[model samples]
Target: MIPSWQRSSQGVPRAEDEIASLKTQLSSISDLQSTRIGEAVAAARDEMAHGLAGRVSMVAELLTEIGGKPENSMLNLAEIQANLEFIGLLRGPEPPDLPTEIEALCERRRLIYDARDVFGDLFDRVREVLEIPEVSVTVVGTVVHDDEVDDETDEEL
Candidate 1:
């Protein structure tokens, strides 16, 4: 027959072990969520960049055709107008293929924000469960503006 304090002491170790396991699982899930968010943002930016590049190429071609055929000024004007319309379509309020990959990225970012908030709460809960004091995490970094500074110095000179 164990004393009451002994029984309580035995339960404390089991509780601590469970808390540690939960903390590990939460950390892993948070890391995975962060990685997915980063991937989604990268994919969206790439898609937008590619679309912009294609639009620029079309505009350049229109300009070249107009420059090459000065006599057909009316035709050139019509071509330019059509090209402009296309550009406007690309940037219009109602996109042809509405709710695109970039839109998905926006949704993913919101989910990431929510997940981060939950992660923070779980971190706090873990600390409480393990009887650990709260701690603040800090990150420090430096930004080097060598190119900008050099350009400014050259302009001054």
Candidate 2:
């Protein structure tokens, strides 16, 4: 009888079945990680969009007040009022604590990425022990600039 590690006359080891099983498990893990990361990313983006919408509305209101007396009398206050009208259409019915929500989402996304990376490294090590080819891992997501958002808003005004 051939050793379990040795190939049979057909040129495949009994371990092939176990290896296939591991592959399936690894694939499932990867799919789950991808899904989770995708969700975190989407949540972060949605939070930012909501936050920015609210901010734009606030900025428009501030501008409406300030635009009344431009240092340059030649500057058209009517244009500012028109812009305010445009922005009014985008305001949320109920204001959210957008800065806090955005910060929380960014933190959540960061933690998820760190966890996924650690798991992926361990998964690859297991595949190596099994003598299976290493699966390539790719992390796809945007880097949340929690600080830059505020800075940009300040600069825009």
Candidate 3:
């Protein structure tokens, strides 16, 4: 049997090369998506804190830590976003052991799953306190800066 190089047309790249290129492009797309989603969530959190719950000490505390990992990672949105992006970088080779990033992969998965429970519980609590109708997480990204959560709060009042 002829080798792939001998049988194939001259100058055409191999399947492996194309796969590697596509993987990098995919990773880049994931990074951008993670960043956009993270920022949108953070902005909504900010609006909820400063706009409607200005006097609620508990909500105010959540706001202060939502943008960062807080001393104890109470509502670690920042870590969740970083984990989301890190998940994108886990592209493995065909049957790849991927030892270099395996430790990181494990750690991030654990953190993200833990954050899910904390985030969901906190989010529900916030909604209960704000007394707002159900809102989709996806819808928040569509809101431009000017049309913030506060806009709806203002209209309600």
> lDDT per residue, candidate 1, 78-154, as tens digits?
45765675577788887655456447546655665665565556555545544568544433344555865887999
lDDT of 2 by residue, 13-108 (tens): 857766998999999999999999999999999999988787666656545544542332322343464456446544857665657655755665
Candidate 1 error regions (>4 Å):
1-12, 68-157
In candidate 1, the residue pairs with backbone N, CA or C atoms under 3 Å apart (3 or more residues apart, or in different chains) clash, namely none
The alpha-carbon RMSD values of the candidates against the true structure, listed in the order shown, are 26.1, 25.3, 32.1
lDDT of 3 at 8: 32
Which residues of candidate 2, in runs, are more than 4 Å off?
1-14, 70-157
Candidate 3: tens digits of C-alpha lDDT, residues 6-123: 4337645566567888999999999999999999999999997786656487676655645543423543565676567556665534443457556766777687677767766776
How well does candidate 2 score on lDDT at residue 103? Answer: 75
TM-score of each: 0.38, 0.37, 0.30
Candidate 1 TM-score, true structure as reference: 0.38
Off by over 4 Å in 3: 1-55, 68-104, 136-157
lDDT agreement with native, every candidate: 0.63, 0.62, 0.67
Ranking by lDDT: 3, 1, 2
> Residue 16 error for model 2, in Å?
1.5
